[model samples]
Target: DTAVSQTPKYLVTQMGNDKSIKCEQNLGHDTMYWYKQDSKKFLKIMFSYNNKELIINETVPNRFSPKSPDKAHLNLHINSLELGDSAVYFCASSQDPSGRPPYNEQFFGPGTRLTVL
Candidate 1:
């Protein structure tokens, strides 16, 4: 079974559109995150949710928002998508900080490729 999964593995859209990507994790992890990989292949954290609480990454733009219905799911929503938004988005999960006696590595899903024209 996949530990983490994301829908719509590829998306192509025009500028100024809105889109959302859904993600689910079956690892029973408490912390879930959304990350963006730009054209340069640099991965940046966009949002993190631990037990359904939001933990925004200050570097992320206001245009991007993340919602988690439960500890097992976190979805990313982007509004007024710009060409700069063209990138791959990854969903990940890790054990809650308190549960990490050792170290917990983040497990990433197959990314969703978003292209804005």
Candidate 2:
């Protein structure tokens, strides 16, 4: 089984539409993250949730929101999607970095490619 997985591997939508991507991890990691990869393939961390609390929130537009109901799931919702929202959204999970050895590795799921027209 995949350690991390995402639904709707591809998403196509129009401008001004709202869409959501679901993600889940079964590795028992305490931290999950949402990342966006631009057309140039530059990946940026959009949100990070650890132990049911949000610990890192980048300067993303208000239109994008990350919700975590528990430690194993982190969902991304985009409201009034814009053309710039077209990108590959990735879900990743990692063990708490505060541990002894400071685990810095993240396991990524098969990304969801979002296209906006």
Candidate 3:
């Protein structure tokens, strides 16, 4: 099986609807994360679940919430979605944080495109 995978590759909804994006990673050794890629191709981490704990990136807005049903599953819920919230969400997994490029290497999932109208 692949290291990471996500569901619902396309999501289109109105501004006020609530939605959830699911992500699963064959994660271990404290290295799995969620990131958002905007239309501009800027990538930013939204959350990281490492060692069975959930860590949300401080830069992410409160509307974006990461729910970890377990150590290996990381999901996202967006409340009161807005037009600006549209983006491609990706889930990724790695082996560890060794402060090197190899350790930082991540196997990414097929992204979910969420378009809020």
Candidate 4:
């Protein structure tokens, strides 16, 4: 069984197009998150959801919106995809809001590589 799954592992498209990435987790966890890894490999948290509540990180752009259909799924929709949005999108989950330990240990999916032309 897949612990986590995302569609269109590799997305290539022209700028200004809208795109979406879907994520689901079978783990009985209360929280899920979306992270974006830039070209430099810097991982940044975009949005987090737990128990149907949305917790968005301030640095995330308005163009990105995260939707959680249920406790088990959180999907990301991007409007007017830009060249700068070309990065690896990763979906992760945690057991609780406190995170794993001193730092949150998130179980991540394979990742979605988005390319903008």
- Tens digits of per-residue lDDT for model 4 on 1-117? 888888879999999999999999998777899999999999998999987689656488899999998988989999999999999999988877776584476778889999999
Encode model 2's per-residue lDDT on 1-117: one tens digit a residue: 999999889999999999999999999999999999999999999999999799999999999989999899999999999999999999999998453566778999999999999
Q: Name the lDDT value of residue 19 in candidate 1.
A: 96
Please give the ranking of all candidate structures by TM-score, highest first, separated by commas: 2, 1, 4, 3
Least well predicted 10-residue stretch by lDDT in candidate 2: 96-105
Compare candidates 1 and 3 on TM-score and give the better one: 1
Worst 10 residues of 4 by lDDT: 96-105
lDDT score, residue 52, model 1? 97
Candidate 4: pairs in clash: none
Q: How many pairs of residues in model 3 come into backbone collision?
A: 0
lDDT of 1 at 7: 94
Order of quality (lDDT): 2, 1, 4, 3
* Residue clash pairs of candidate 3: none
- The C-alpha lDDT values of all candidates are 0.90, 0.94, 0.81, 0.88
Which residue runs does candidate 4 get wrong by more than 4 Å?
A: 100-103
- TM-score versus the correct structure, for each prediction: 0.93, 0.95, 0.88, 0.93
